[model samples]
Target: MPEDPGLPAGWQADSVDGDAPAEVERLTELLRAHERAARGWASGSEEDVLVEVHGLETRENVVVRDDTGTIRAWGSVHDRAEGRMLYVHIVDRTLADDVATRCSDVLFAWAEAQARQVGAERGLEVQQIDTGAFADDERQHAWLERAGFTCVRTWWQMSRSVEPEEVELVAYPEAWSRDGVEFRLVRREAGGLPDEADLRAVHEVLEGAFTDHFNSAEETFQEFIHRLREDPGHRWDHWWLALVDGEPAGALVGTVSESSQGPDGSYVSYLGVLDTARGRGVAKGLLHTIIADAAARGRDRVGLEVDADSPTGADGLYTAMGWGTKYVTESWHREVPVS
Candidate 1:
């Protein structure tokens, strides 16, 4: 038997960045290729993915290779959600065929180990790890089952093409508004980065709004801010906040989808409204701001993900506002005990 039976026979795994510059560049290329195969879109330039790799706070990244030393997979357990939840992103192109059984086995073991480590450090009895599979990817679904991840949620990747003429008419019903609610663009510091205080306020609003969300967890200030900054398309001017009676009541962070749609379009990275702000026009107002900005900026469309089963019926709102699901993805999760 191999020293690590979870790995394919004669295959080996190593840290993603344990070597020289050339190796890092090669791994980045591998990552790009793997991502394109998995998601139908290339991840980013080498520099872009490297920035993301370095920004991860508590992560274990690995590259797997066969005996001939050709890299076949990349996997990571990224603790961006502060140990309450870990994200497992793995892509395999091993000769083991469409199943990728060995890669799934090894990657999942690594993720569970990291989950346990972080949960113990945080004094928690359990922590959950999440991973995604395309809704129609049966091979990946089977692999996830073998790794013990239960299919937890389905999400829609929704997008709406926009024209300048319709931006002003996009619906934010006047009746949904309480008096004195308004949307404001986030301002930045001298370097054109979001002012630190404003960024923190956005994070705080998101943390509060998602308290009742499925599998929710608070991403730390540092993690939340830096992880978003790592995106090559990120920009301060794209962020916004909503105010009700001059108090911060909602927040939305939008990023240019340069990798997929270029500067001609943007994605709503996040949208949240305070508990007290719910049932008001805050969420819709924030989304309206995004579409209007896209129109004003000459962008083609705005895109976002919505929980398929959101209690608030967010999907209904998106569809009513002209967004349609371009594709669907599923989240699979497993909880690991600290002990």
Candidate 2:
């Protein structure tokens, strides 16, 4: 019998454990090459991508190598979405179209199939397959369309360089206090981990705050902490909680990431203030705290991302606070039925 057409020709597929340093380095180089031409990818070192695939658990990380044994692309579905969604990544534009198509199509199809399977396990009502492509990369857009994805939303990738300044420069403490808001880092134990009680408080605040945010979903506490810990720079000290009159009112979670152009600085992975606590400077207070802590640690920048069409006008808040857009990426999603 002839080889299966559903599988790419002259390509061998291997399911990786997603825990190898070699795999991370290979994918990072492949992505960096694509970045040069597309500028659509979020950039970071091998450690960044390494920690990602090797996250809590990945359904699979597929490597596509030509007959010559050259890596043309890398793809993966980090199966952490609790079956509601499958988040995938494929390093496009790094290989010739014929070869890339043969490899990538198979990888993408595998991801979709895996999403359905996982969703079934979780008893989900609908399954979503999520991925991204640069707005300008028609090649990727074309591939996405051919594979059944539709462009839904555009995202702004923004960053800002940080400089040393007095806490007065952030200057929000007094204003926040007047509104009965207080900011403090999550308490740490002698062993250097965040206090369990304080950590749980931060999670509760975020759960309530993003109830109306985009594509919001409930995540188990195990999933939340493990996902963030996968980053190489995650630390207990970087987490903070805001109090309104000594009651937990909000939370901010920041971490450092690898940056090639400058020193690695803090990235706001999550920030939320309860609905009832809005308009009282809790968000501002958290930003000020992050900035002050970054300065204290001698880091050179503080970066964050916001939904461009956010109803809350979050992009405006970040712009006024000194961050600016670096580039853009878009979310392309397609729904699949759980089987």
Candidate 3:
């Protein structure tokens, strides 16, 4: 049984059953409201909420409801990798400040206990709580600071407008070359599934490419594949590979984006070029391919996130490729010792 997070009188912590329609709807609305407050716009749907909370075996979720049975706060923890856990903290922005702070405290306490539980299950002595906030979200920053999390990094959320003419402007044939580097989509077999060898190559290239990036942690190949597959928009054809001298050297994994107010878009979930192939236009080729593919599919934009402090000047590269900053966010982390 999960431990209870002692809350103020008449408030109680309970587990979230992702299969319940009412539960899903309530959570979705809470998340969207939180985003709307932080960013002036929101993008998540009920489908996104389902993808997040459905994997009960790999995730822990808690919700606080008042005596009136109204949910006012939620906390979810994902055992993302061997040593890392991801946290989602949401409280009703409409509540009074003191009441909201108390609710936030209860959620954070629940999260810490859940973190230790997951850490022990994974046979680790310490676990990291990774969470994010919009750049201008001062309330969230205050909550995180009071909970002992440190602001570690900043990111630029960027997007590029795609036009049908880009399909002619950017060459994305099955096989294309630039500066002695070759780019191609990961091949699919008769079963409509990606080739295992190509999948492994893409994973290896990405694992190597991000080795020196901020907070880099080792994620097993199985974990990588499983996590990516959990996304509702995942598609086999969105995976691309780059080669130099016919050897795997870079990769870009994309996903379809669903929008209620506008045309759907494409998102660059992962993009990396191995150090050995960095200067040969491998990254540029992969970017152009995704933009061209999005245009061909009538997607209006392509979106991605980048480290604000990247030493490689990656944001500059995105800007040069016609991508502009849509918004900014920050990473907040807290390390907890497992009992």
Candidate 4:
């Protein structure tokens, strides 16, 4: 009797299973390699980098191999309900021609099935699959479009090279001061988390600030905390909070990301000002604080991504601060029912 050929003669698919240490190590190594390759190719982290594949609430990996048993490509699905999102984080095809097409077909089919499973579990009618490709990555973009995804939003990967002398002149806007309003950079205390109350205040400010923006998902307090904790670079000291009339009004959350694909350095992960606080220059003030902090920390550069079409015209603010657009990426969204 001959050995059974899995999925015809030239193709094989396998489901990645088990949480064994070896399995986790293999997945992490694969993910890191994928990330490095993507950064080398695209100048930044892969949009779908899966940092915690083993701990994802819902995930499935499909590996396609050739007749020689060498893995050619893999895909994965991660489902999160807090934001009511189903993210297809991994879809890579190293094979060429029919083999690649076949692998993609199997991958997307698995993703759709996973989405259906999530819907069944949550009693929702539909779920979204969000993906992005570097502006230079036309091939991936084409693959996504051909797979029924559409580009809905674009983001700019912006950066400002650190020059201490240049940054010294980048003063916090003094013209828009509010009486009794104060600004402070968060600092780490011995074995202490950032003041929880201060963090909550910043969360409230962010929620109120971005309410009208595109795909502005309303994050619960817990969700905000969960997200910050998940990031490998999250640091409380890098955060800044603004108070208007002694009340919290705006904030900037900064962190050091290995994802920058540049020198290890601080990045302004988010910058926001509440609607009522916008005209007071709080956003600029917060940004100035973060940039100065990054420079003082000996960081090579400070980077951030912004919606190209932000209503507040944030890109202009960043540009004025010496940041230049390094690259662009488009977000592809598929609408699915909320319920």
- Each candidate's number of clashing pairs is 0, 0, 0, 1
For candidate 3, which ten residues in a row score worst on lDDT? 1-10
Judging by TM-score, tell me the better candidate of 1 and 3: 3
Model 4 per-residue lDDT tens digits across residues 182-301: 678654466776777778888888888888888776767876777666666787777788888877898888888564445576788878788777677777777767766666666678
- Best-fitting candidate, measured by lDDT? 3
**Across residues 224-316, which tens digit of lDDT does each residue of candidate 2 receive?**
787777778787778888898789998999988656777768889899999888888888888888887777777888888788778998888
Q: Candidate 3 clash total?
A: 0
Give the candidate number with the greatest TM-score.
3
User: On TM-score, who's better, 2 or 3?
Assistant: 3
Where in model 2 is the C-alpha error above 4 Å?
Answer: 1-9, 17-21, 40-42, 56-59, 92-94, 170-178
List lDDT for all candidates, in order: 0.75, 0.74, 0.89, 0.65
> Cα RMSD (Å) per model?
3.8, 2.9, 1.6, 4.9
TM per model? 0.86, 0.90, 0.96, 0.81
Clashes of 4: 1
User: Which residue pairs overlap in candidate 1's backbone?
Assistant: none
Q: Rank the candidates by lDDT, best first.
A: 3, 1, 2, 4
TM-score of the candidate numbered 4? 0.81
